[model samples]
Target: MAKLFPFLQIHDFLSDKLSKEILDYAEARQADFSPSTTSSGGGMAMVTNQRISMTLKDLAEFGPAIRENILAIAPGIIEQLKISPFEIGEIELQLAAHGDGALFVTHIDTGVHEKSEKPRIISLVYYMHTQPKKFSGGHLRMHTLPIGEDDVQPVDITPDHNSLIAFPSFAPHEVLPVVAPNVAFKDWRFAVNCWIHRA
Candidate 1:
C-alpha cells in the first residue's frame, strides 16, 4: 500500500499463460470495444474528447478465470487498504484499450453509473500490455489532496505488464496520455478494469 494514498499493488497478478489467453480474447473481440463514456452531473454517459479510449463491458462471461481470481483476492485487497468491509455486490469487469494519444483526464471512479442500485466501492486496474513496452505514457496517476494552497501532488504508477493495482473508487486519478507511434492494436495499452460494488 502507498504511504499516503490507500492502494494495493501486486506484480504478476496472473499466471503468464492465463495472461496471454486473456489478451488474445480481448484482441479477438476488438470489434466490440466502443468509445468509453464519461458521467455528467445528471448521471448521463456521453463520449467526449476528454476521454479517448475504447471499452467492452460485461466481459465476465467470457473471462471467468479473470473474474474469479479477482474476487478471490478482493477481500485481501480491501483489508490491506483498510477500507471498511461491506457485502460485495455485482462486480463490473471490462476490457479497456488505450490507443495512440488516448487518455482519460483526472477523475474519480465512483459515479460512472450513478443509477445502479449498488455503488462502486473499489477500483482495480490490471495492465496486460506487451513486453518491452511498445507504448509510452498511459501511466495511472493518483492525485493527493491539495497541500495548503499547493496543487494536488501526483503519484505516477507505471502500467507494468501483468501487474494489478487497487484503490478506493472515490480516489481521484487519471490515465495519462498514451503515445503508441505507428503501432498496431497489440501495441496499445490494454487493461482490465474491475469495479467492486457495495451491496
Candidate 2:
C-alpha cells in the first residue's frame, strides 16, 4: 500500500474570542450564502448542497491573521508531506455553514480545474462553533488511497471548535452529513475553508 500521511489537526488554532468574531461576521453576511457548485464551469455533479463561500478579497482585513498563520505553518507541512517546497500563492477562503442534512460528497480539491494554470496544492479547514455546540454529525472523513488489494479504512476527524485541519489538496475526503436538529442556520456547522496554491 502507498504510504499515507495523516491529516494535521491543531487544537486551539484561534482563541475563543477571535473564533467567535469570525463566526459572527459570517452570520452577518447571510445574504452571500447560496447553493454551492462543484467542478469548473459551475458543474454540480460532484457536490450537492446549500452552502456559501467568500474569497480573501471578500474577507478583506478580517482574513490576514488567518492567512498569516497558514503561511507560517506551510514550511513544516511541506516538509512533513515531503512535497516540493512551494511559496504560497492565492488563497481561496470560504465560510461553509452546514445546516440540517448538509453534506459534501467525497472528492479531491485538486484537479477539479483541469485547464487552470494554477491548482490548489494544500487544503486547510478551521473549525468554529459556539459553546454548547448546536450541531452534530459533521465530521470530516478522509479516505486512504489503497495501493493494492488491501482495503484502507478512512479516518474521521471531529469538527472541534477553534481547531485547524490541514492536508494535501489532492487527498480524497468528504464532510459527512450534518444533523442540526434545531435547524437554525446560525447554529449550524461552520468552518473556514482555505485552499493554498503553489506560487
Candidate 3:
C-alpha cells in the first residue's frame, strides 16, 4: 500500500532538564551499547560502529520527562494512524549513535503479530540532535513508491535534531551511513523509536 511520510518539529519536545537527564544517562551507559547488525549476516563492521541504546520494553526506565513527552505525543500519532486504540501497544525508545564511521543499512520495520487486532500500523522516530550537520551522510530516506518505478523518489529527512519523524512502520526506509570526515560535538546521533501496535 502507498504510504505518506510526515515530519513534525515539535519545539521543545523534551524539556531541557529531561534532555540533559537522558543525555547523561546515555553517555554514562554508552559503553554498555553493543553493535546491532541486520539479519542479513553483517557484522559490526558490516554497517558501521554504532549501538542500540535501548529496547522496546524499557521505555519507562529512561526517565519521567522523556516518558511524559512520549505519552503526550504518541496518542496523536496513533490517531493519525486511523487504528483502534486497543490495537496499539507500548512504545519503545532506542538511543542510536554513530562514531567516526557508522552506517545503517536500508530495511523495513516488522509489524506486530500477524494474528493481533492492531498489528503494526505506524512507526515513529525522533531526532535528538539539534545540529544535524555535525554528522554527515546519515540522511534518512523513505521510499513511498517501489524502487525501479517512477515515483516521488523518496523523502529525505536529515537529522535536524529535535525533529520528530513518523511514518508507516512497514514502509521501506534506511540510513545512508555517516560518511562525514569528522563526527559532531556530542558525536552521537541520538534518536527515539516509537511504534503503534496491535493490542
Predictions in order: lDDT:
0.84, 0.76, 0.58
Give stretches of model 2 more than 4 Å off: 1-3, 40-57, 111-116, 148-152
Best-to-worst order by lDDT is 1, 2, 3
TM-scores for every candidate against the unseen true structure: 0.90, 0.85, 0.71
TM-score of 2: 0.85
Q: Of the candidates numbered 1 and 3, which has the greater TM-score value?
A: 1
Question: What's model 1's overall lDDT?
Answer: 0.84
lDDT (Cα, tens digit) per residue for candidate 2, span 1-199 = 6445457888998867788888888778777776666664455444334322222226645688788878888898777766788877777776677777878778888843234456788899999877788878989998888675655578899999999999999888888888887766667788888888876
**Which window of 10 residues has the lowest lDDT sum in candidate 1?**
145-154
**Which digits, one per residue and each the tens of the lDDT, describe model 3 over residues 19-51?**
666656656666566565443322222433332
Q: Candidate 1 clashing pairs?
A: none
Question: What are the RMSDs of all candidates, in order?
Answer: 3.1, 3.4, 5.2
lDDT for 80 (candidate 1)? 90
After superposing all C-alphas onto the true structure, candidate 3 shows an RMSD in angstroms of 5.2
Which candidate leads in lDDT? 1
Candidate 3: 10-residue stretch with minimal lDDT:
48-57
TM-score of 1: 0.90
